[model samples]
Target: MGVATTWHGTTILGVLRDGVVAVAGDGQVTAGDVVLKHRARKIRPLFDGHVVAGFAGAVADALTLFDKFEQHLKAWDGDLRRAAVELAREWRTDRYLRRLEAQLLVGDPGQLLLLSGEGDVIEPDDGVAAIGTGGPYAAAAARALLRHTGLTAPQIARAAMQVAADLCIYTNDQVTLITVPPERQEYEADDR
Candidate 1:
């Protein structure tokens, strides 16, 4: 058998604070030890921009999953939790989806969830979740920032991504952040 190609690079983080939810992702895609691309956008606004989602793993696989998730969102009338659960169930059971190697972090105004191909839909108790090679570092930094500072959700997500980039060779400094503001509240403008 031929050697398996390992896809690496990417750090995705989600943080919910003060009624706002933010998801951030670093822009680096690597194949084995070689860097293939920079400025890859792994974070996307879904369901008419009512939710933000980010992914880590093979780019094609993640994109496929994103499309599937959006369909579920539409079917569920933009209910994030239901859409996430349905996606997780299908991802675990469907033959093609079961083979996908990717993880998703999705967030809306009221919820933040991590979905896996293993039939897992996890909602973090601390309102922070992360995935990919630098996930742990990002999660730790975000937790500290959430506890010690009054920064907004977007700020915490960006800062935590920066920390992960600084520590993980697989992650880069270029980040894309998307946020879903609290229900009935206007979206906050930030310098991107």
Candidate 2:
């Protein structure tokens, strides 16, 4: 029997700055050495648009994880960290979920987290996280931009994805970005 081929190719970056959180993802999908699609959206808004998530790995698996994470968010009342932790635990322990090959970067107004199938829920010290084939490249660029420039979270995320696209063949320039508004804004909108 031949081995099953896994679909790949994506770069997801999340940046938190000045009370804003932005997540960006590339639109490239690859199977083996072949480029399958461009303009594939890997970033999604969750928790009544108060949270943003991006994924890197098999498309189907990531989608499933997204749904699961959303359920956790609802259960936890939109708590980003709590939802991420629950997802990570289930992804690691559940027999069916353990086979999923994907990584997630999720953020809300107050937190940025990286979730893995290995039960890891990591929050970066600098409020920046990335995953996928070009993750390292994007993450490094994001850190530099965050430190040196006064760009907003979205701008930094976009720039970082661009840098990743330029360097990684698997990553493309077509980026989908989503942002979660600050906590104060959410409260203000509720009051209005």
Candidate 3:
């Protein structure tokens, strides 16, 4: 709110399959035509490990929204849908929050949702969601993998992020993934 934060360049993807959910994010940040950071983490657990969220946009703005959403989660008693909806509503209508340039992909074991400043809280029909520069590619890849491959949710998420990193200039192979329906554990692809 004090100073406008720079836009964060990266990719984040989420997948839900067979009662499990996984989220992955690339670790690259760029400014203008120059790369700034190579290991920024964009996905995190919230509400006492019940929900996982990945964000794309200004890092400060995203963190602010994340903190607010955490409060919403607490207020809603860890209800993912309610917390997401309330965050979206506030982001859409609140004077300051409406200016945040960020999009959120949040989920639990059974649900994946996308929240935006436009007051949209969407549940992906195919249990796949993505945000950031490489979002479309990752989402499409995950959808295809879900439809045609026997990969688990975590596998699909990691693969999709890898696919995104290959195609999107802003995205990279330094991916961080987390799975739900079991306890959260971090997974990284090859570390290249």
Candidate 4:
């Protein structure tokens, strides 16, 4: 079943595999039955391109969260998990932020996380997650692809977003993607 979205139409998903992580989003903005815009980018690179993030909700609110999250990233010295957690805590406890209806999928080469206004910071067990109107379908498609095929992280993310667009009326095929590739030094013991 498709989830209900009042006016914000979006589908955002991410996948992590073999040291590669990617996030993808569909660009469709709707107001009830009306399609307002197409090609509205929802996926973006953050922290000097070290992290990637996607969002689903009111565009204004999502932008606000993005700015706040960026500050958290700076404060944490680019720690993805810590930045996400701080953002979640603020989103949940700050009354003004609590009223913002949005969800974030963020990651680096080594991790993928989901943050919500409910003070939740989640790391999917399978290194795949989704949010927005077509989130479930996209998530399921990514999981299936991950289990049955050897698609690269970006390929899997893009394909799953396409499936979501086909199934979710709120989503469209105009997809954008951002990825982080593995570096050899990241695997070194001293690097960790």
Candidate 5:
């Protein structure tokens, strides 16, 4: 389902704390090299159970992948990481799907992840991570927060958002977050 679609701007970030895991993304939609829309939601709740997904590519592909991923997760006894890797493998193996590139992050209570084209699921320690356009800035800020101040999950998320916003114009209305309790495999999206 694609003639051409460049109106895809998104970011995905994840952090693993001692007891909780948090993630965030920016909201911007662009076509090719032009900004087509602002305040687009890149992060979304897939199953409303406990896991969240952030995509950065064809919106259609994102939707399709997410649905399939959800189905697989449900059938697999809620294995978030394994499910995410399977999603990436499917995307990479399927020729048409390979074209609609997307990045995804799946997290549970004690783990946070970054999923990409090569089917990489990177778990950043020191609990700092980010993706999309403002990824670098957010990651940097997360590192600073982790190093300089002992902040909670919310504080780290806010700091990452602020830093990302300062570095990228798209982040002003794009800061989004989700958290999972240490003992849980699902997550809750933060409204603030």
Candidate 6:
């Protein structure tokens, strides 16, 4: 959206295992066959709070959605699960949204949420979900991390970043992570 327009890809991933979650993305973004940029953070902090989101195309669109989603959440004092579901529902039925140019993966302190217009507010009981470049790889890594260690929020985020790092999927500055611990998750971003 600035000096760099490298935020498209086909390898973003996320995983949920043993009640823990980890999501990862590659550093490379492609527009058709051309790599547009590197080290972009597909995974991002939403509402500047505990909820996190990641996407794999049309960076601007994804960001716009996040902004509106966050505002809706705040406006209603909404729960993550319900808010996510509502957003997905809207995205799915709205005439204009029916053609969103990107895919979105959203998560918060209490649960992991994925919205693809296939369904909304889906809380994966299996403990995992993901979207974007290097997604499969990240999902695999998350499963491995979950199996080996019943990770906490920070641990999950760290694991996701580690997996993305190995694939040269992210840049040093582009990767960032945060978490919301169960009860304290709701006001996560604004807690400080």
State which candidate, 1 or 5, has the greater lDDT: 1
Each model's lDDT comes to 0.89, 0.88, 0.88, 0.87, 0.68, 0.58
Candidate 1 clashing pairs, residues 3+ apart or interchain: none
Instruction: Please give the RMSD to the true structure for each candidate, in Å.
Output: 3.8, 5.6, 3.5, 7.5, 4.4, 6.0
Q: Rank the candidates by lDDT, best first.
A: 1, 3, 2, 4, 5, 6
Query: How many backbone clashes are present in model 5?
Result: 4
TM-score of 6: 0.71
lDDT: worst 10-residue window of model 3: 183-192
Q: What residue runs in model 5 are displaced by over 4 Å at the alpha carbon?
A: 1-8, 32-34, 182-192
Q: In what order do the candidates fall by TM-score, top score first?
A: 1, 3, 2, 4, 5, 6
Which tens-of-lDDT digit does each residue in 1-192 have in candidate 1? Answer: 989978889899999997799888888889889997777888888988899988998778999999999999999999999999999999999999999999999999899999999999999999999999999999999999999999999889889989999999999888888888633322222223
| Regions of candidate 2 where Cα sits further than 4 Å from its true position | 1-3, 182-192
Task: Give per-residue CA lDDT, model 3, range 1-192, as digits (tens).
Answer: 576545546799999998888999998989867787888889988877788998999878999999999999999998999999999998999999999988888999879999999999999889999999999999999999999999999989988988898888899988898777655487553333
- Candidate 6 stretches greater than 4 Å from native: 1-26, 150-152, 160-174, 181-192
**Global CA lDDT of candidate 3, please?**
0.88
What digit string (tens of lDDT, one per residue) describes model 4 on residues 1-192? Answer: 987757968899999998889888888889889998777888777998898888988878988999999999999999999999999999999989999988999999889999999999999999999999999999999999999999988889889988999999999988877788533211101100
Instruction: Estimate TM-scores for all models.
Output: 0.92, 0.91, 0.92, 0.90, 0.80, 0.71
Best by lDDT: 1
Residues 5-92, model 2: lDDT tens digits? 8767889999999878998888888988899888788887898889988888877898999999999999999988989999999999
Show where candidate 3 strays beyond 4 Å: 1-8, 187-192
